[model samples]
Target: MKDDVDTIALVVVLVLFAAVTVLGFKAARWSRGSSLASLDEWGLGGRRFGTWVTWFLLGGDLYTAYTFIAVPAVLFASGAQGFFAVPYTIIVYPLVFLFLPRLWSVSHRRGYVTPADFVRGRFGSRALALAIALTGILATMPYIALQLVGIQAVFEVMGLGGSSNILVADAPLFLAFAILAAYTYSSGLRAPALIAFVKDALIYLVIAVAIIYIPTKLGGWTGIFDAAEKKLTALDGAAGNPADFSFAGVGQAWPYATLALGSAMALFMYPHAITAVLSSKNRSVPRRNAAILPAYSFLLALLALLGFMAIAVGVNPVGLNGKPNAQLSIPLLFETMFPSWFAGVAFAAVAIGALVPAAIMSIAAANLWSRNVYKAFLRPGASHADEAKQSKVVSLLVKFGALLFVLGLDKSYAINLQLLGGIWILQTFPAIVFGLYTRWFHRWALFAGWAVGMIYGTWTAYNIPNPASGAQHFGGSTAAIPLLGEKGYVAFTAWVLNVVVTVVLTLVFRAFKVAEGHDETSPDDYHADAGEPGVRDVATPGAAGKAGAAAEA
Candidate 1:
């Protein structure tokens, strides 16, 4: 790791990072769950977080480091297309307000640990649960890798990376991971939960200062917008830059709308988002947080505008690889536009942003493994302590696996995979979200629809050559809609197809008298509150069904 900028900036980042490290270790005691030896305590903070804590935690969890990095970078490199994130965040809250409370109620009533666990209980299908678990793990790895990419961007801008020797250049990132892994293993979900307060506070401060300060330095908002649009108008595709992006044209109307809607639908389906929601103490926590979480969307909208401010001030960030890396634009902007001391704080915000989401994501993925893969299939009789232990170990393994994606693959590929990750996870929506209310969807049909969506989305995304760089596959997310012939997001198209196939097959199954898997939930369970008699601490794999059975009996 090298420090190319003023030492204060890098030092500031390290100091703040070290502070969070201490906070992470201390979080295990903050809420004081019954036993850290159970997934309920370790993975979900014993489902005891109140409204304020849950708000900050979900804010920190959803508004990730990647969100700060990529959204602005997209606005910097492309144009209006990056703004899709803003509307999607807006759309998600109402949707979350409507369904998440039901999910929370059922989860607490039956002691469900992961969404896959809920899928299993709701549908009584192990194969389907495994499908959901595998999809979540697959979708989350690239997302976790994206967080590393966010950190790498900060390091590059700080002059800490960009070495020819792989190990030497990435050593600092590895160290950060080491610290994050240690704390997450020790504190579980609480590490990020506790640290989120600082993360959000730093973020609000940085964003507030940036929107007010940066625009003034650049001749105000109008000038920033004009400069961004003018620069966007004058784009020649970079010769070898895979990071090059296309500005969407008039036809972008459909694609942009679909992208926003698809993203909104898909966001909550992510294991990390679900984990955050499930960690809340009651049904009202999610609904209330959903109403307030849009505050982050406002922050995000302001953050995206900074891309234009970067253009206005002429902040050009060259990556460690000696290319114009748009992702580093914001960090470089702060370093160039702000005083050295404040710039350090901005860098810390970016780094800490990566940490909160990364920690939550790792825990979520590990919970999926422990609950659905290990306890469900490998060792059906694994105890609560055993599940917790398996999760801690797998959380470490998940971090290492994400590291491999960063070290071994192209950073752009990781970004592409994250986009694909959305598409992949959205497929599960038919099974989980729809299953939340209705059991009419045949389990076999749900599984088949999920597979269809996964295969079709991956294939379509694979065929989309990069509009900017002309890469062969997985180039971007938008494609020509199948029937409308209008350009639209592949995920939405795949989701529509998934829904159609599921509906058709459901009817076919009904005609043929196919068996519907036994559902372990009742109508009353969907609205049960925290104080209800059946509401218990989270259940392990083999135990959730028993808990529900006993509650009913």
Candidate 2:
């Protein structure tokens, strides 16, 4: 059971890691903006990224190391249910295509830094905007933590995490994080955007090698699938468990379909996703990226097959702490099958994947804190430079907070909390996504719906027990809907309730003649493009200087 550290692989990973760190620090000057003192330059990369940069940045920001690790890990554990990710990601692009252009347009038109900024402009309700901002920051914290888990999985597989002393074992991880924090503080979003090109190149190279080489070594895809079927079917239909080794069992379709749909809906609702979209130079960037991003979905489908490949290879990886670690499946699979040097490449891919998204999520969360919480509540008269400085400080805090999640919580609990985050973030859909199209929902009603959905989603997610983990609550993301007689994703069910409540309350509020908040956005703003006068004007350096002066005046 003792795994030896491959010195060659370790050295290779270290070299690549060092190279990325250097690139991250230098990224502050990559785009060469006039200044990095404003949120536009530091947080959103000056909102002038071209199509290719947008593709790599959004891909690295969204696919994430957590996606690379967790998707295959789930497939290794649960069989076909894990393939839900493939469909979810496939459907997500089309869903975003329907609304993101509008969001990008309006955001660019008004110089909004976060989705909460859009919400405030759209509804003119500070309380509602605060709710959206808090939900974003809260949901994003666990997501950033999961990226660390992705990195830790690689460390454990490479024999860097087997130490008995906590300090000795985690020292490497903390060092990697410190490097990530330093570069992010120096370069902001540009760090990740630049590093993403290298990170993604390595990932594609690793995944391409894995799909072609591993299957041949395992007796081809047919042999691999047969071995997986043999192993998984033996465990099928255990008491109180859904059937394994099949597409899905009876009554399982609802959960599977709903999980896919709900996740697709929630995908772009995340602030980081919005941040990636808004950072683009024009509406066409997101529209074009949406069409091309599904190329990653094809890669993901290939990656999911690695879970079955793990079964065929008899790979059972234990965590550094000696607990069973499903997340380590792919990393250990590479170690077992590939040579020392190539295994290092695969491990580095996962580790760097973690760094890319962690930087973006922290930056997005920091933007939320600065624009909605600090500037609105604590410093309404703050200048642009003041906001940027505060965000940099908050970004460091956010990274360390994610580090706490990795060090303080159990890995299984951390994964469950991430799933819980999906549920919590999905509740914001009513206000953000629906608001993009209409102002019919009363602002107070949307807030009320958000509260109800948050309460319901959290309670349901907390109460579901994981029979395998032996935990009493917070075990999974799927639950039975009351009176529906079917199990479904908790987030989608809560969303249904959220909409219903919003509809009901909107009518009641209208009948009572309650005041609706002013809408700061004009109808034309939704369709405005980079060619529009307002967008062109805001893109000017002089306009930014004037705005800063006016704020100070």
Candidate 3:
């Protein structure tokens, strides 16, 4: 539980950071398209990435710094409930396998960069697309802020110094984020797409080594679980409490299960997630990646073991102002066990892992702003180059904003922003997801749903109280809604209420023959592929076939 990073570890960390910075600059050349002028290329990496690249890109973007630190941290603090991340990640792939291909096909054929692009095309309403885009960008900001939180955790572990010197604790963080902002601005999605390989490799190496070596240090798998159970059981505070405490509580399996499901539903709605999906060369790439990517789930299962190891090794959270720093469990475990050099690599991996997703998220958010807000309202006739330029500038600003979040904001508050993101973005499901299949709901009704859901979700989240933290409305997802009268339900519960209102209002509006927006897209658009004739806006079947055959022959 002390600052133990060695000089050798520091050198290795420096080397890896240098390698990633170089890779960021080099990414601009990896799959250079005919031009970087258009959103199709700049915003989406030319929309030509193969299945392999996309697998890594989407995997890297989705399984973020929080996924690396927070899941294990939760497990170390709680128990089996933290394992919900594993099942949720697993469950998400099947849903992606089924839905994302259709989304990909439609987006590809429509020249859509953001999901809002498709929403506008399908709904024939600028306001609807703007709403979806706004939701995406807003949801993604806090999520990006949490990525910085991951990097900060890594710095706290690696620097291993007192926070008395603000400059010492924060100087390295500023430098790292500055490098990330520059590269993402210069290279766009290419930076993160290329660096994901290193990020993932380091993560696998650290997790694999920890799984084999750390468990041996604690005896074995049996000993590790036993020690964890014993430690948690010693904390029993109630007559009916379970023998081993989980993160949430005893006898509340449904809340965790529902939380997992709700999280999966909202995951794809995040602008960053959708941006990665839209960048694929073909629809099948996303489907194939979904099927194969669960291999990370296997790794996540190993990462969760770090939590139990923390318990077995008796790595108690250090007292910072008399509060346990639950986030330090993994870092403490690694420092205590690994040699200097390997621990350094582990620290660098987490720090660099934060950058990869953070860059992509900023780009995604910036694209939403340029395309849905700037182009939609301000510059109706803006060129692709103009949109790309605007996005690059916004991406830089986003990183700076994340820097402020890390420097000034509480880490728990940042995490609550992420939960709020989930709740707010989930409100768009009725618009984005259902809009993909049908236009039965009136556009105004969808707008009403989004507005109501956003207000209710934010208000509810704002009012919840945490007795432990003395914070109002946003401690952690563990807090509940009084109206729901259910435990373990938080943001997800807010989403459910949002959906019910959406459905009921849609029915009422439909019965009255309200003026729903035009559906410019047809059902056939969802099935169109790159090789299909007239796939993009310029072609129909006859013209599309000629183009494909020309390219082939």
Candidate 4:
């Protein structure tokens, strides 16, 4: 994968990188509000984004560099298992459609900045909120690292990195991460919000071209799939395992279905996903986006096909270690298949795609730490300005933390951790989503459930060895279901236990007459909309019944 640097592509990449750096800074004043010294403004884009802005924001940031690099790489590596991402993206919207508007409305009316904020309000449990926040930040770290891994893949293809020294190999990525930290520090959520527009356009443009033009060279979709299938079946036959390379076979079906289902449940639970949702101008904005956001699904399906195209084109990329690296599949595919300048544009798209989501993810994680961890424990009386300052600083640290994961661990480790993160995050669904409609589950019970789920999920993931590398733990996302003797997503299995524990604990707590704590929200809060009379800037937390406070005041 290392060669003479494509001078033309390198220049294009740097030029585009500099261009987005400017946008990230200019976004600070794009939609001027009273100030940017608070979580509402600094971390959630002042909650002023309308439908189209929200659309681009979610579109670019949500799909992420992982979608661009990892999904295709997985397809290139294993065939059908990677296609799980496609159906999961489709399944996620309808699941979100049912509950996200309710979340938006409640958060819009109540000044909630994170999912943990909602949990705190609904359950009146600081411990539960802390668990939710910690899980989000923990789950988010590897996901962010994967984005850097995307940029690293692009750099490797361009011959910018492939050194024996860690610092030398990662210097270009370090520069990209530094620029991202700077803009996010200065502009906060606005940085990613503005940059997302360019990211979306470039990704669509690059994919549109690659799908049409590259397939023509490879003799079209028929040849691509035929080549992919032939290669996959031959490998499976060699191993004495007959998986249908064209589709997930009988043995693979349960894991595929559960992966899709569990992943769909976990997608919106990430702090970054909630940050985008909470940034919308109003409740209607989220609902509208939910219905329309699936447009990205069509794009995702097309993106996954690039994997087969990689297989068809006979792409065989090696990593800096000179080992066959499936993660390099797409980037090297572009480098090999396209002209230098066009390949440069494609690389820029992948690199910028990583930046947008990485910024958002860092912001989301920092906000979680500030609101739930810092303010909740260390400085309970902190001001909005103080919280904003803390989050700005923490966001920088979070990116570096991701850099640590990228530099220190395996590339596949980031991917597996993301899957594990999904398992961890799904545990919060019962606490946050259920509390939206009813307070039937006691707060302590929810906390206990989360603990059980987190511990169980982590243990199960730790035991599933990677068959290829022979790593003894965290190798894959799936495990066997209880009593079923079949593999399903560990996250879903953990979630099932999480719910059962929560239900049983709730009954026991009720029987023993344990206090249910307090609920700050009334029924109206979940259905309230923007500009409703006396709706305070719900992005900021204050007062006993702040949800009903007037914005104009």
Candidate 5:
């Protein structure tokens, strides 16, 4: 690929980044609350964002840079199997429809910031909540790392940076993340909620242009698919052909379907996704987003085609020391096709896509720590001011931790950790999702199920191997169990194991007449917000409250 370090396009991207960074900090005053004193205000934008803000926030939250670059990269590498991302996204809305409202209602009524908050409150088990929190934060770190990888691609293609130099290449990555961290700490969820509009608009423009322009340049979709099919079918003569690129077969279809379903189930469970969910002013916003967000899925269908288009157009990645670097496939395509200026805009969009989500994830992780660990274990009597102070500090630390992931981990390995994230996060489904509808399962049993599922999923994922890919641990999720040789999707299968363990143990404990934990919430509590009676141990007494409130008004 021809390289230009000082192109006007690259300059535009840097300028846009600087603009968004300024905009991010400016959000501190956009919807300033009276005080940032509670989890409601600090963790969830005071749970008051309207429908439009929620839509942009969730859009930015879900459609990540990983989705932008990697989905097509996977298609470029493995053919039709990678297209499963489309169907899974399509399926996720109906799935969330069944349970997310309940989660929102329950969490809102009880002032819960994290899913772990609900878990602890519902099951009355701090241990179970801790497990949920840890899983959420761990799963999110690799995802954050992948976002940096996305930004790095734009920089690399522009000839400004690469991963070769730790400080030289990564300084910009750190600067971008540092800006995100500072704003999220200052403005809470509102920073990203506000910035998401700009991010999503840029992404939609880039993707829309690329979808129309690229296909036309490559002789349309029919030509692209045909060319891709042929190229992928041709095997390497040097390496013995073990993996087949043929799109048809039960072996292929089953894994594709299962992976899609597993991914959809795991998507909303990520703390970042739910953080966006809880930020909505009303429960209906999420349901509406779930129904309408599939419009982006339509966009995703277009994005996935780029992978096939790469093959049709003969867009080969630049080889690194004679070995193909699959990660560069999309970057090389952009470099080859897009004009310097539009290409720079596209690069800025991808970089911004990474930034918005990284900030949200860091804040989500910090909320988990402040509420569950820092306040719960370390300082039970901490004031609201102290809690807010702690969360802001923790947010910055979390960003640095994610920066470490980008610098220290291999790009491919970082992506695999994200896959492992899906597996680990899905383990929380049985406890968090199921508990929303029923409290029938024993709290202790839920903890036990979590422990077993985490162990099984981690152990099974660690043992997967692909010789052609040279991926030993956490390669692709599979049905085959290690040592035992029993087959199942690690996430869905482990979830079943988790549910079974919880149910059976719940029955046993019930038969023994175990003493259940107290439920601090009432039915009305689910509908309660800040001003409601007993919403947070606050009392707004009758006559004095009414007369005083009216006079102040």
Candidate 6:
């Protein structure tokens, strides 16, 4: 359907966008630090966020605009399978509860700004740390692009994407991204941390209203489900296979279960998630937030039901190229179901949601590059201020790279790239997560395993075709295991191979007396907390020497 410009909704969205932009610029002064010259201040919000701020920041970080858009889109396109996100998110907090506090403690004690920083300090291998850092940047760039896709979906629904001229069509998207990139450069992580407050408020309010109002208008959940069932069951795939609307069939259960498990493991492995965890003021903040974050999972489950609601209302959204676009289902649903002003508010929630995670991801990616790649490889003695400057500049480039993904590539291709990113990132788990608890895996063996897993995952993902999208490769996340008869999430399968290779190689290399690099961290460092004795001096050599002198005095 061709949509005219939603002038009222556009005005409301612009107003909210302006308000958030103001907050983003002023956030440099929020909880004002001594200087914004250090990565500790710029990349991490000075590591002083308490329970409430951490809650919202982490929420804004993980439950991204993509989650607000794609989860429901998958449900709208393919029923029940899309709900794998719900279980994945539900299982994630418990997994996070197990390890994140330890990560936060070690990072805080040692002044590690990125996961690669912790990996380098733990294993003493720049090569291994470089792998983790590069994978993070690779995985995150497409994700940030997905955020732009989220914002674009809203814009397209508001009729900003129907222009005959390309520049005119994408002007709003470029402008929004430019503003986000500017504030993030000037204010750093604080910009996103501050904007997360308004983002979450708008999100919760929109979701609350959507669940209540849309169901009643559609005659409740029963009616919505029936309509969806009727519509989906009648629709056949290109191969003429009837769609599975109720739940995963016998063939799909493994993929569903494994996708959830793999995603749960990979969630915390992402740099942005760790950035949020590391920014917390205390160790207990993450533990408490882990318990509380599942509340958003409940909201996500409710949001997933909006797919059925859209089907019931017969909402069909067209993309910029005038093709069928499931990503616009929720945005179009609100446009049809709600008044103009309320729809504007819903669109703003998603657009602002994009901003928070995009800022966080770009910052995380920049920190990884600056700390691991730039500092370790390019300049060994770069100062803290130098690191911060590199990150700010790189953050802008990262956003532009993502902008290219949105402008140059197909939207579904971007989505598939993000799925591929999950596959690639999960390959880092053995190096980062397992290394956290034990250093038994030889550094060389871990690197080999990562290389093997990455190659296998990419090769496997490249062969799986999506008949619906008419793509011959990289179409899905699940594939048949080599020996096992059942299909499973390719990441989990690849990870299993990764562990097997690591274990076998570790035994052989250790028996041969292969040199494992020195471990720079102590056991006690893993349990260190904020306000601990000597914690303040760990990051500063001068402070440490002065404190030693004071002790002698």
Global lDDT scores for all candidate models: 0.84, 0.85, 0.76, 0.86, 0.76, 0.85
* TM-score for each candidate, following the candidate numbering: 0.93, 0.95, 0.92, 0.95, 0.90, 0.95
How many Å off is the CA of 364 in candidate 4? 0.9
**Runs in model 2 with CA error above 4 Å?**
237-246, 408-410, 413-417, 536-553
| Backbone N/Cα/C clashes per model | 1, 0, 6, 2, 1, 0
RMSD, each candidate, Å? 5.2, 4.1, 4.2, 4.0, 4.7, 4.5
**lDDT score, candidate 4:** 0.86
* Deviating ranges (above 4 Å) for candidate 1: 1-5, 236-249, 412-417, 467-470, 537-553
**What is the Cα-based TM-score of model 2?**
0.95
lDDT digits (tens) for residues 366-443 of candidate 5:
888888888888999988778888889988887777777676644542345466678889989988888777778898
What is the clash tally of candidate 1? 1
lDDT of 1 by residue, 1-553 (tens): 2246568888889899999999999877665534689888899886777788888888888888657888888888777788888999999999989899999999888889899989999999999999999999988887888888888888888887667898988987898889889999999998898899899999999999998887777778889888876777666233321222345555677978998999999999999999998888778888888888888888999998887888887887667776556778888888888888899999999999998999999999999999999999999999999999999999999889889867754454334546777999999998889999899999999998999999999899888886454467777888898879998889899999999999999999989999888899999999999888898755333323432232222
lDDT, candidate 1, at 149 = 84
Report the Cα lDDT for residue 80, model 1.
76
Candidate 2 local lDDT, 1-553, one digit each (tens):
3467779889999999999999999888665456788888889887877688888998999888657888788777777777888899999999999899999989988889999999999988999999999999988887888888888888878888788898888887788778888999999898998899999999999999999999889899999888877766766755445445355766779888998899899889988999988888888988999999999899889888888999899998677677787888888899999999999999999999989989999999999999999999999999999999998999989888888767765565344556667898999998999999999999999999999999999889878887766767767888988789799999999999999999999999999989999998988889999877887433434334533332212
- lDDT of candidate model 1 versus the reference: 0.84
Stretches off by above 4 angstroms in model 5 are 1-6, 236-250, 319-323, 413-415, 466-471, 479-488, 524-553
TM-score of 3: 0.92
